[model samples]
Target chain A: MKVLVADDEPQIRRALKVGLERHGYKVVEAADGEEALDVFAEQSPNVVILDLAMPRLDGLGVCRELRGWSQVPIIILSVRGRDDDKIGALDLGADDYLTKPFSIEELLARMRAVLRRVEAGQASEPTAVTVGELTIDFARRTVTRGGTELHLTPLEFDILRYLALNPDRVLTHRQLLTRVWGDEYAEDSHTLRVHISNLRAKIEPDPMRPRYLRTEPRVGYRFLSGRS
Target chain B: MPTTRCVYSYAVALAGVAAMTAALAALESVRHIANDSMLYLLVVIGVAVRYGSGPSVAASIASFLAFDWFFVQPHHGFTVSDPAEWLALVLFLCTAITVGQLTAMLRSRAEEAGQREMEAAALAEASWSVASQLDLDHALRVVLDRVVQISGAGDATLLGEKAGAHQVLAQVGDALDPAEHGLLVLPLGAGERIGYLVLRLPPGRELSMAERRAVNSLALHAGVVLERDRLMRVEAQTQALHEADRLKTALLSMVSHDFRSPLAAIKASAGSLMAPGEPLDEDTQSELLSGIITAVDRLNRMVENVLALSRLEAGAWRPMVEPTPVEEVVASALEPLSAESSARVEVSLEPGLGEVPVDPVQMAQVLYNLVENALRYSPPRAPVEVRAWRGYGSFVFEVADRGPGLPLGSETHLFEPFWRGPGLGESARAGVGLGLALCRGLVEAHGGEITALRRQGGGTVFRVELRREVGR
Candidate 1:
């Protein structure tokens, strides 16, 4: 994998380049946001990690311009670590965000996750997600519990599919809202909650004490498989 | 000059007697002379009320002479032929002079009362108008308006001293040159003159006693208002200084306590790594290297926290909102954790969990801080569970660690900056206690809230709630 690390800090750029290269990835470096765009066009790196603050054409601008044409996974690195900076990059279609003083391992993992999601989008392959007695067939857009067909609204089915795909992992309300209802509806956690309860009523043995679709108080919900 | 003024008074007195005698002569042709003396007394009283005691006394004496000359049988100069006529003239003279004196005294007293009432009304009205205005300039203007009205002056100007020179704050009527002479300038305020109230009267006109009194009262009212406004401004400035002082104290404490430890650690570790001679073993060197990195990281974190706190207090941090997936934020936050720490964190993300409109970077920082705090407080193998879900119209994130729960009564101050729990072990007191405070600041910046609770299974659970946007 070829990864481009664009940062104004020499230490960070050098460290990331050395560290990522050691992990069997070709590393490209840019001193600023403008240079990052130039290097990105010329080298056509597989992934790009951008720094928010740059001398000219900051990270948000670059992210916006890149997202216009290529759906390349873009990760932002911000020293300020303010919400606005992160949200600006994300809203402009950057794939992920990381604050400064971040570990190289975390940056690589985010890059991988973004790239994998892109690959998954391109493959267009359907898969079956089975958790406990509930099974979701992505290809057929069907869900069954214990070999019996369970009727579900399309919204409920989508919520379940997303939860089942990432079993045992906690998803935030915002994540669910954006994925299911698009980015514009990302803040509508109430709608997500209602749908989640409805999904639980259908799949969970007891809606009050959900087994498959479990509520993680103050967070979101987690789909815990029977095995872990 | 004195005799001439007396002659004018006697002339007025003679005119009153002559008019009265002519009228009595016409009445004598038909009516009896019983009330003739009483008619002369009426003329005496009228002269006393209109003019003063000098003219009235002269008129009373003149009427007696006219009565003796025209009506008494001996119609000559001032001689009385009968003794009865002499007695009647004496009684008439005594009664007329006494009535004239009494009438004059009552007239002066009534005029004094009228003047006092007018002054009191003007003072009351001026105070009401000035008190209604909260702004100093506006109050001065109202006072100037009152000044012109009450003084009957052609114009009025209020001058405030600035840099040793008077500047006009408010003016009414014709524009008067600032250099114009003969202005009725009264100094306003109690001690040092805050301003001057200048009134220009009409040409050759003088203010009455009541008008002069009204002007003085209005000036006093204006001074009181101006003084109050100055005090309020000084009070606001003092309040701002106090707030700045408080921030400085907080910063000093933070620097003294939080900033020093990491610097000391980094210095010691770097010194060992760069030491001369046989060079340490590979294991020892790597350990020292990691130590150096950890120390630097801690220092960086402290700087970021301090900056964040200042930014929050300054109200400079504005959240850039976007649709952020909670799981993505949690995952990103966990990315920096060591392998052992990562293993200890048990993340249970609700599937199909949608996005929330928030500043994801701030939210991620909140998650990172909570998780990091949990790691520090708990044993290496003890599990820390991070969970997220939707509740009502909000998204919730909770970081629960199986560590010693917060000390009793410490939960309330958990999110306060630099607040450390008492009776903590040395290892538990490893951080500067800014993590939770920064998390609170970041979360609140997005219109969210953060709180802490004791877990039922003996741990501390920090919960964050971000309100969901309704109807997009």
Candidate 2:
């Protein structure tokens, strides 16, 4: 996979390039937003990570222009963790949003998640994912626990499918809201929590002390198979 | 039609004639002609001093005619008895007229002196009034009012450039119609037409010498005051710009120091781990990896906090407040801190506590700062307590820690940026002191209040009060 990292800070670009290259992906670096667009046209990377604040043609402007011609996965790197900046970037057709000072590991996980969704959508072929006692059949659109059928509401099924497909990776509340409930519900984390709690109650042996579905504190939810 | 004083002077002249005739008749036995003539001269001089030049001159002429008819020889006839009497009459008329003219001149000089003194005093008063007013707007108004009053004009106004356009600054009496009426525009400042004082005097009426002097002096005073006002405004603008520049520099330095330190550490550690020659032990590798993680974590927190502070400073943070449960927000804020610090705090919220109207994310930041501050200050073993309840129609959240209490009288300065308490050393107070200041900004932006106070028994208590109802 080819990834483009655009940031004004030399150290951030250097670090991202080293880390992404070490992970066996071809990496291209841009020092500014204008350069980022030029590199995107020339290199045609599979994914792009953009820093929101840049000299000339900031991340939002680039995201907007790039979305007009291409549907490439774009992840916004913002120092501002406020919901407004995230929503603005997402509304402008960014695929994901990550706050700054994030580790290479977290960035890699986010990029993988976004790439998987894009690839899966393009392939259109469904697959089943099994983690611990829970089995999610994407073709049948059903979830079962330990060979026994477990009925779930459609919303709950969608949430479980998203979580099971990206197991062991953390998802932000905004990311899940945009994916599951649509873009208009991007600012509401309360609804997401309620749905997640309802889903956990039906699946987990003890809802109070969940073993498979885990909350990453203020961030979001992650599904652990509990095998590790 | 004669003036009343002129008629009175004529009567006095006739009276003098009658009195002299009666005196001559009574003193017919001993008559000295020169002495009797001197009595008529006394009447002319008295009238000249009493009445003014016009009445005095009339008295002098009348006395001359009466003396020619009655005192001179050949009184019953139309001719003088002798040419010598003609000379005596001419001398007497000249003496009376000259004496009347001198007396009139002396009276006018005294009156002019008094009038000049009054004008000077008025000018002094105007200067004092203008000088005393420090406020530019009020000073301009007072100056316009004085200009109109002293000049006896129908009205007065001041015009100056404000915000790149010429507009009326102050006016008194009727609103000035510059197009309709003639105006006396006195330009303020050195020849540059920075401002103008305009007066509208009635047609056919002009300022007298004294009034003119007073008006001119008042205009000068007004000009000085207007110039002072302009300078003051420029000074204020320059000061504001200077402050903004200073803040930008401070922010730049702060960002450079805070961001680079952690990046350097993380970079060094990451480089060492990935170095080819480092075939290090497992323990050393894990330690290096963990070090990189910690540095990254610190960088993340600092980055997030600084961004939040900048947004708040820029007045760009518009929170979307809703009725939210306080416990959920607190739990979310505490989630990331609990495991890392190993200082778990369980807040016992009051049952049936009403929902607080707040922005969920910002409120989380507020709670996070308070909780993290509590954790940082207290001993690792001491439990941090969070208590919540509704009081006085507002939701209150208190974070109390069993740490050394804040220095006395630091409550006021506690929420100020870069303010660290006296007891904490450099290492103890990690992270820039933006946590509490950011908390205060976010809280206030939400129409809530945050305060730090010394706890009753020991330690410090941070209390945040959120209004029950949300307002836009």
Candidate 3:
């Protein structure tokens, strides 16, 4: 797999290159957003790790340009407290984001998750999926926890199914609303919150410490399964 | 006529002459009227006193005609039969005309004097209004209302131009229509047109010279008031900028020391580990690696605190409040601590205590900062307690530590930015003193309050109380 790392700081890029190369992955580097796009077109890397602040063009601009013609998974690297920019990148179709000062292990985990999602998209659909003690049957349209059926409203089931299909990926409120309730209800996050709380109560063993469904806070929700 | 006063004055002149003639005729039937033409002169003087020159002259001419035609020898005719009587009648006419002209002149002089006095009073009142009221809207309204009252305008509006858009600063009575014929637009300010006064007078009515002058002075006063307001705003802005500059300088000096120390340690440790000449032992290498990690963690914490402080000062961070469980907040707060540190800390929440409305992310940061402070101050292996409960009409939480109590008279000073406790030697655990300040900012942004008090027996307790229903 080839990974494109675009950041203005030379130390961060060098550190990432060494870390990924030691993990046996081919690493391509770019210093800014424009070069990032150029390298992305030339090398056609499998995944791109883009930084938010750069000279010439910023990360959001690059994310928008790449998403215009490419579906290659992109993860945004942003500084803490830039919640608006992170959400903007996510809304512009970036796959995921990691706040700055993150460890190499965390970055590798994000990369692997996005790659797994892409592969899942290309593969044939599965009839049933299981993560931990929770099992969902797409064909049967039912959810079971440890071999016993858990009752769910139709709307709750639909929300769960959509999240399950895109596990370990941060889905924005607009994306989820547009998919489940159609475009007319795309901005009704309050309604989405009510349904999510109900769904969490039924599925998670302890709603306080969620094991499957995780909230990204001010962004959206992420469904975490046992595997990457 | 340009004014209704002109038309009313002409009608009064005609009516006065006719009334006097009728009275003379009625008196002649009752008794012998000696010099009855004198009654006509009375009418002429009355008209001259009330109305000015033109109507008084008309009254004089009308009185002469009526007296000669009604009471002379040849009745209903302008001729006088007897020469002495005719001379007497002609003399009466001359006396009436001269007296009417003199009285009209005196009346006008008095009217002008009254007008000047009224104009002075109006100007003084407007000046006082502008000077007394610091509120620009009220002052402008007073000036506009005075303009309308003195100028006899049906309505008045003060239109100010700001950034190429016209705004109605103050309006009195009805709105002035631009299409109205009697609209008077007076531009304000001495050099540039800062604003304008639009007045709508009654149809066919125009302002007298004195009224116009008074209105102009009032408009000028409004302009001065606006200029003064602008100057005040600029002064306030400059003061705020200067204060912010001072804070930034202080922050920079303090941050540089904190940042460089950690950076220097990390650089030295990394450099020694990467050096080629000497191979270090395994234990020494491990120690160096751990040292580097510790330095990086300190730098990261400092960076977070600084970013949070700056964002708070800039008013960029607003709490996105939602209903959040207390357990979740506590869990997230503890998530960042090392396993050993987390085990040392004890968490006790009120059973059945449900959710509270707050920004979970920010609330967690507040709890984390407090808990971290408590853990840092307490002796090694001494338990730091985190408690949450429902207070009276509020949600309250406290972080208690069994360590050294707060310094005397330093309870409030503990929340000021860059305030470090004295007597602590330079060590790896020392903070940049921004954590508590950031906690206060975050809590207050949610319309909540945070306080620190010496614990009853041993240590200190940092308490935070948030409104149950955040009015956002």
Q: Pick the candidate with the highest DockQ.
A: 3
Per-candidate TM equals 0.56, 0.58, 0.78
DockQ score for candidate 3: 0.26
Alpha carbon lDDT of residue A178, candidate 3? 88
Reference-based lDDT, each prediction: 0.77, 0.75, 0.86
lDDT of 2 by residue, A175-196 (tens): 8898999999987887887677
Question: Which candidate leads in lDDT?
Answer: 3
Q: Each model's RMSD to truth, in Å?
A: 9.9, 11.9, 6.0
**DockQ scores of all models, one per candidate:** 0.08, 0.10, 0.26
Model 3 lDDT per residue over B1-472, tens place? 3557888998899899999888888989899778888888777888899877788888888888888888888898888889998788778878988999999999988878898888788888888987888899999988888888888887899888777976889888876644567579887877987888899888777788878888898888889888888889999899879868866875775666667787898899999999998799999999998888888878888878888877877788888888777776776677677767877778888887877898888998999899889988999989989899999899999999998889888788789877666765454444436889899999999999999999998999999999999987
* Of 1 and 3, the candidate ranking higher by TM-score: 3
Q: lDDT rank, highest first?
A: 3, 1, 2
Q: Higher DockQ: candidate 2 or 3?
A: 3
Q: What is the lDDT of residue B373 in candidate 3?
A: 90
Would you give me the overall lDDT of model 2? 0.75
